[model samples]
Target: MAKPKSGAKKTTPAGKAGAKPAAKKDNTARLDLIKNASKRVAKATTKLVKAVPEAAKVAKAAVKKAALPEKAPEEKAPKAAAAKAPEEKAPKAAAAKAPAAKKAAAPPAKTATAAAKAPAAKAAGGKASGKAGGAASAPVVPAADRPRPRATKLPPPGEPLTKREMEQLLTAGEGRGVTGEGSLKGRLVLVNDMPNLVVVGRDKRELTFLLQGPDQEVLPAYVDHKVSVSGLIRKTTNHGGVVDVRKYSAKKPEAEVVEVAPAETEPRLRYLSPGEVSMVTAAGMGAGIKGFASIRGNLEMTGEEFVLVVSNGGTRQQVSFLIEGKAASKGLRKHVGHTLQLQGVVDKTSGWGGRISAETVEPRPSEARAVSRDEMELVHIEGEVPTSVDVKLNHGLTVRLPEQPGFTWAIEPTVAKRVGLREANFEPGPNGGPATREFFFTPRNPGTFEVEFFLAKALTPGQVDRSFKINVTVKP
Candidate 1:
């Protein structure tokens, strides 16, 4: 009687255990489901997302209270069954397809989904997949939680492989962890948030690698440009690799270099002012005729324009004033190469040694004293020496300079005023000789004076070709 009762009690428990699958639709299983929901929601809120903690707490409390009667048996049963069920099936389906098919659940998703949608969905996905996997003929194993078969440990990376081994491995598609040195031709590209070398391998299959090196910065400049890379290469994935670049070069044309002209260094052009006119006039080498200076100086052709030679602050500062109006220059045109006092306005333009716009023209009053022929003294000039001369105060003076072709010898107007000029005569040189011009003058006062004559081109008067000076002493 005791044996049968014990047998019956054991039978009842076995029947109850087997009957739980049918009970999945029953009220007890439903309550257990509610408990599972409570746990998942609490984990999702408090542990995973940590969002809506209060709501999760309220839900857990309500579900826990609802599932109190069934929690002890129902909660422990599923977990125990999950643990024991895989052990039973793992040998039958020892070739686990779950590793690949369920690998998605293995890794963490890098980019998060919308928070409101992800937490509950994620909890449901993780918890539900285990249950669903157990039901399928594929056997139950959450890829992340599966006990992996012990693999044969590979040797530590030794020497780099040969080019032939690399070629064969690429063709075989089985070169999982081989290292080698080889040159690869490809277009540099950005992929998977990293710069990669993409090359077409055996059967036109594309191989990719995450590029790394000191020179990786130059990769962007070579994008879409054909490049050759040589270095240590290692196979990380079946068709992918990583290469620590030892060398790289681009098949690109040389960049063009442009030559820029040097910046302008010429000084700015400016006006020659009337203030300089005051210096010449104050020196008695010029005069201010009706408020216009330089009127007393000789009109000479400096270039194409009329210029008045005048002394300026004891320096060779030349002033050129252009005739601004045609009517203003009418009186001055006939006076080129002559000395006179003329009323004019001096204006400026480019490179006319000078031209004054005159309103009226006149012959200047001679300041030379009358001297008779008996008092005249003739002078001869020898080879460029003995430049000093002496004369009686009331006696006439003559100075001469040899003339040559293609150039003209003229007295510097300012220096000429030191020896008052009353007459000038050109004497033709003795038969077939160069001509000589005699400059006859008298000293207006008894003092030492310096005289100068210069040779210059007809077109460029601003430049002097050659000049000579003489010191003359006049004694009373």
Candidate 2:
């Protein structure tokens, strides 16, 4: 085969000789490996079986020992006797010490109990003390802390006095020099530059008292007549008594008195003729007379001077004059519309007006007549009649005539019929010293009618005397 070809080589038939030995060697190696493995397994199994039995035996012994009860050591009789002896004696010893322990705590408990009862005892003591002291034990409050008394309320201001009430107040002496919370019913008048409440006594004597206190503020408003002031009165030596006004009430005038006639010797004025006054006025000329010149006219105010409008028939002229003395301006207002007779000197003259230095100004007297019957006087009251006065057609017009010294006023029948005069009466003075007359008249129709007021002796019945003509214009 070696010589056969280098590439072709050797071949083996079925059941070749070296293949059987190689196979047998592999089988033997495999069987030896399996046997060695089997030996290892068998040895492991045997060791396991032995370990299980030993473990079981050791576990059984542990269980048996755990289940068995433990035995205590026996005690000697002398030690037990000693322990028993102490137990029997302990109660007596504790009993002996308990008193001391309680004694030590007793002071604190007593103190606590005393502290709790002390407040109650003190409260009881306080109640007893309060009862013993009565009102004295009550808390005393300071004057500043005490409740204040309520203030007294003053009465409301009074109503104004009527003309009728003013006459009655002046005549009545009810409230004169009354002191210590009293009231004075009268007309307030200014006397000697001071406020005075003028009242007439039962004897017809006029009494005047000074007005004082807070009422002074309102007293000025009611200068001539007003309310009845109530308060304390203090009498002085020289000046008169004063009233400390506290409250006031409204008053009205009542009850009339007869007016006296004017004096016969009263100065009569010389009025210039209508033609002469017109000619002088048209020429813008003045009389240039320095002596007394009596002029009749209405008084008017211009700036600080007083002017008089003199009318002669249809001719009118304005003359300026200065009032002498310290007369109040308010007193001049009453004569604004009334006719006045002026006595003055023509100091200067101008085209518009003339300046005059006035000595005296008086109310111009009107002509009067007497009536034969008991008929009322139809006095025509006009010009600056207060709007507050109620003027009705059927109602009588109450005219307050100025007080005269010695005269009786009467109405003419013819004049009364024209003015529808109904009644007439007299009232005491509003100024408290003189007497005044009130004439009541009813108008038949609204027209300008001339009525006459006659002045006669007090006892005379039918006598032709001084007649005062009044032009009455009735309004609807």
Candidate 3:
């Protein structure tokens, strides 16, 4: 400390000992450039700690490449969950050799939420072993997206068997057998060269089958509804039978409006005349009636013949008789619905349309006459029709009928407006055995009117095979 004083005090102790060896020789190159910039920030934090676990193994190999379409149906798993195949190929060979620039630093919403939890943990935990952040991975199901097996064929061209297959069309003898566990109730057809699923029964019989398990999406929404199925029956082909469907129950009926009172616009029958009831059992069973007449109505009996319906206003007639005695057939069923007063005879020579032949049936006091005479013009009769007739004014009412070997009688010009036609013929018989027609009505205006007839096979009255009514009453 005393050597400086002589050099001009060596300028203050020789500038503090030559400024400590040149500021420690320039802070030794700024602490060796901050120790080589802290060794290049410790080699960029050790390459971001080795690229954040190689970007989480390239985001678990982009969620095992979005579960390689469900691991190619993992050979349909289940061999005891595919018993240890090299520990499930060690995390799919480390996620298929990860390194695609670690999926640009991973985390795209955690690789789409681990790509939807590896197909619901391979469908509720089964083919497990998939662990890059495992939640029981196992998805990779792409053999063009699974689900194809039931095939044997027959539903293309107006396709119906449940839109060409979904499991109900097992073709091998393509149906017409298997049926005997019984339970069908009707309707549901699809026929047109069936493939399987018919039902039509209610005695129409037709059973076909195959709509099992979940009833193939529930019995095709009841095709033509009215179902009632009830499983197991297989007869394949003795004309038909196949019902494997199980437990069914549908319905949809609603439409009725019948009201047949004295209304006759067709459907008003009284057939079976076997040659006019053997000519009324040889003219004696009908007691061979003839001239005098006085009928009235309401006495029914039909089967062994006794007729007499006679209503009016809305018209109705029916009067077949032969009342003999023993007190007139003892309690003649307490006179059915009394209102009688017959005293007949009018068998007008045959087919018995007026069939009177009575001889006493008294219960009168209900007489309400009103048919102003006009006398005959064509007044004949024949082959059935007499429950209580009594026509007159504008006469000319011959009827005759008798042909029926397939059919022919027509008259529905909007319901023969109370009889007006006037002429028609065809007698030929004795040789052909069954021929006879005549119809010639007249009464255009009277109180109790009616006059239908239908026996179809074209003449256009349609559908009523053998019906004939004549509820006559035309009087004044």
Candidate 4:
């Protein structure tokens, strides 16, 4: 401010000192960045180019392999030997068709029961609209036609009824017509998706009911197939001190009979991982549901019972197969793992488990079928842990183990000599199946032990035998 000094003696002029040098430095930095960026781009381009050639080579090799024809049998001696065995001839087509014809002619009628009728709808005034009003109405069982002496009182409109009450109404002395009598009017949820419906009142208790008609019929229900039951609801206690119901009719009473075709005609199925629940959900939620077939995965037998895990095309699943049989046998251990075709009723069960009932089990295409850890894990844990395991082998063969930590079948044996220590040991299983051998070695002294077995000549590197690893410790 004193004189607004025009220039400093030791400083460069403002235009020449800072501006040009700063500009030069900026240009140099920009050039360096541009050079580095070009180098990176060029490196990436070179890698991509190299990868393309390698990928092309692989593709070409695959194409060439695909073009090659399958190798013919180097030795036709087996075919010639088979031709000599007249007994080895293929099964007759007529013999096969005969059994199939018999099966087709068989009628599955378990009993003589009339078709189911849908229950009546409730009017806005809190009264039952009654059973079907259109065609297919229940044959009129007039008051005079009913067993003599009609029911004392038609059940209430908004309350749940008991099993005894229902029985009383069903037996409500002949001539006591129950049509429009409102015998079933409440929420009826089946127990475990069971055919036996457990009527629930507004209070949410089990209401036992007598499903009386000319004959007894199995009612079909999916998990949570919620619908209003509007027939006579007789509330009373049974001998078991449980609320009983007498549902005269339902709005939808035709037990949904899902008929599946025989196993041979079964469809090819895509398997899914366990986490894929949406696939199964979509199947059940279909509006016009028909029967379902188990495709994709193997039908496994555990504890003597069979089950199928249905896999969708993706990594998820939509259903599972549940077979009705005696509780799994205690000695049960192993089963085949090839995909199987099964036929049964598709049902929705309580909780996470639901699906179809398999009446038939047919083998599908696969390399080998064996029980995997994933299959064993599906077993429902109850009671004490089992000491031994039994596995089902192909061709009606069965294997048994007397103790744990001994033979892991995969690598343990191949030839008869290797089936057991020095000799083959065999025992019959419960199901009239062949016996399997196991070798036991209880070390007499406590020490580090290394056990090794020769790899079977018949086993390939990719076969299951290569993956078996067994470790055990013994103390005396």
Candidate 5:
């Protein structure tokens, strides 16, 4: 080991060289750090420059999205073309999108907010694209200009109706008739002077149908003739279900034929008395002979049947009759309370007790007198009277004769008897009014009669009214 003096400087090759190298290393490190920092700043600035363009693109997209609503005008142009033809719709839609693409390329503003709104702008653009496509693809037609479907008529006879067609016919409103095909085997009868075809249904039900044609000439020839008719069933206001005949054909006659000797006979119409009609009705014998009968009675309805109550010698008997026509039914109901004379053939069957096939029904002759108000006043009767007065048999008439306050009146009994007056009453004068007399008399028979009233004397003097006469016509 070498001994070293005190306060001597120590020098080592490695140390000296190492110290310089360390200093150089430190400087190189600092330079490398500065270079790295500069590179980072340049990279950051480049990135910022690149991001500015991207943000501008995003802003352009956002602006385009904001302006999407403004493209409504372009969208509407396709509507006109769509109305003309559907094929031109695609070209119109493509034209609408070109403007949006051009607008998106030019950015409105370069900002962070624009970048943030990029996603929303893209979404809005997608929606606008879809709306534009939809508007162009579909064309709307005005409802008023569209052609309507034609109505279908009913099928002809022998052609079965479909389910849908039958439903339509059933749902048709009242007064509308549905046509049907069926066999109508019946006898022809005159109702209200109009020909009608009476038919018995398959269910053993009787139905009367009105016959109408060019002149109703088709039905009369078919009397007692079996027929097959195609008609329209309708419900009337008064008459029950009636069918209007449209077409009819006669059926083949019976095949059975037997030779028999001809016997001479004549149908004699015998007049039926009330007692004979009553006995026949009670016996329930079917229509045996053609008879003539006239009965005055009131009409009453029981269920679907109409009954005529005839009063003969204080005895009331019911006679039922089936109304065959609408006019007859309506007239019967109209004149229900009035006295009607029915002339018809009396028929008795097991089903119906007693019925009359009435050929004619009319109101009975009225035996009553109608006196006008002016005529009543001409007889010297005072006060307001009815416009028209009806004097019937067993009905009395009351007359009020007016007189002055100081006048005395006298009625002759002999004149009253001649006038068919049963009794007469005189009422005293009221306060501050003229005297009044009331006469009541029941007419014995139908004739014209006159009564005399004499003014005997007047206490007031100078009033000389001698006598007056009143004429009254009685009726039975």
Candidate 6:
């Protein structure tokens, strides 16, 4: 009312114009307060954002410091643990290497003789087991399973020879040229359509005997009374091998010679004629006086006690006697060329050489037993005569080798006309030095044979010189 009087021109309610202005001012102040608060909040958010990185850096530094171990034991714990891990693995590794080390040392230790015992015993047992395995694995080769030849020329069954008779026959010769002589006394019998004389005794293979007389005489004697013949043991080169009577005496006590008629079933020894002998001059001898003797050139079968021929190299009448019941030998120098009279019984028909038994070998006043490896000085016991020899090669040649040799060789026939080997069959062990070889060979034909020896160049220079003396034994 007082304000309205002052103005007087316009009058308005107190709630209208003044109230509108107050409301506007209140709104403006409220807006200003809200704006100020928003500003403060924005400033606080900016400060917080700016401090976040510094806080994080401080936290990181604290974490790093906290992670570091302060004590020596604490710091060393991790390193110790790491070392222990390797140690744990190392034990297993060492355990594995232990066996390897033992294996490496085993070979040398086994050479100590004492350590070899167990292994050797195990090896022997293994060998025995292997033998058993081999026996089981081998295919049976029975008599029935054996291969039958298209033509088999086997001798017919004959009477058996006796042990006492064999002993007596084998023990008689002592002097030169079958001085020893022996005989078997027995009744004659017919076997497989063949006449044979036999004695009763048990010993050795081929106990059966054969007839030493003509078929007619042997047949009659076999059909009639008991017959006994006394003579030196003569090896006949027929029907594998057999002994024949070199000098025979037929009948009982007093002894009588029965005229025999030749027949088909007679033993070849019976009809064989006495071997011829000839004398020769100037001959050479082998290194030893009684070494192997042979003719200068190849000769056919003479069917005599010993063939006589002129010496090829030296000057001396050499006498060669085909001595029965003795092993043949090679490697001689002095006796190679010789010519002399042969004093030994021989079967001309069957090419046999004979020897008397030891009982029949009685030494004369001038003769004495010689026991020496070198007997070249013994004159009475040594003579020069042409001889026939069979060269023998070792059997077991084509076997796998355990180790390589310095030299190798092949065989060649230098002088032998009748060679007993095939090409690519065998290789000698070495050259010049001691050469040895076992060979398996297929014979060209079935017959009494001989072979010469030679060497071929199968090695290069720089290899040591090897010489091999092949000692061959011929089996009849």
Q: List the residue pairs that clash in candidate 5.
A: none
The TM-score, computed over Cα atoms with residue i paired to residue i, of candidate 2 is: 0.18
Q: Relative to the unseen true structure, what is the C-alpha lDDT of residue 297 in candidate 4, on a scale of 0 to 100?
A: 45
Q: How do all models score by TM-score?
A: 0.27, 0.18, 0.20, 0.18, 0.19, 0.14
Query: Model 4, stretches more than 4 Å misplaced?
Result: 1-278, 281-296, 302-304, 309-320, 324-338, 348-352, 359-362, 368-476
Q: Can you write out model 2's per-residue Cα lDDT over 33-148, one digit (the tens) per residue?
A: 44443343344334333433343343344334443222112212322333333333333333444344434434443443343344334433443443444434446666675443
Measured on C-alpha atoms, candidate 5 has an lDDT of: 0.47
Counting clashing residue pairs in each candidate, in order, gives: 1, 22, 33, 42, 0, 48
Off by over 4 Å in 5: 1-270, 273-290, 311-319, 323-327, 350-353, 365-476
Best candidate, TM-score: 1
* Global Cα lDDT for candidate 4: 0.33
Which candidate has the highest lDDT of all? Answer: 1
Which candidate do you rate higher for lDDT, 1 or 5?
1
Model 2 lowest lDDT segment of ten:
311-320
Model 3 scores worst on lDDT over the 10 consecutive residues at 311-320
- Ten-residue segment with the worst summed lDDT in candidate 4? 111-120
Give the TM-score comparing model 5 with the true structure, all chains together. Answer: 0.19
TM-score order of candidates, best first? 1, 3, 5, 2, 4, 6
Candidate 6 RMSD to the real structure: 44.0
- State candidate 4's TM-score: 0.18
User: Model 1 reaches what TM-score against the true structure?
Assistant: 0.27
Please list the C-alpha lDDT of all candidates, in the order they appear.
0.53, 0.48, 0.47, 0.33, 0.47, 0.32
How well is each residue in 1-476 modelled by candidate 6, as lDDT tens digits?
24556646775767785563433345555445444433433443344334334433433443344433122343234334333433343344335443544344333333322322333344335434444555555566666654422211323333444555445333323111222234555556566555455554333322234544333333444443456554333333211113244434455344577979766682333211222221111222122112112222111011212122222210011122232322211221122222222222332221111221111111113213222214222111011112343323322112111112322222333212233332221112233232232222322333454332222212121132432333222432
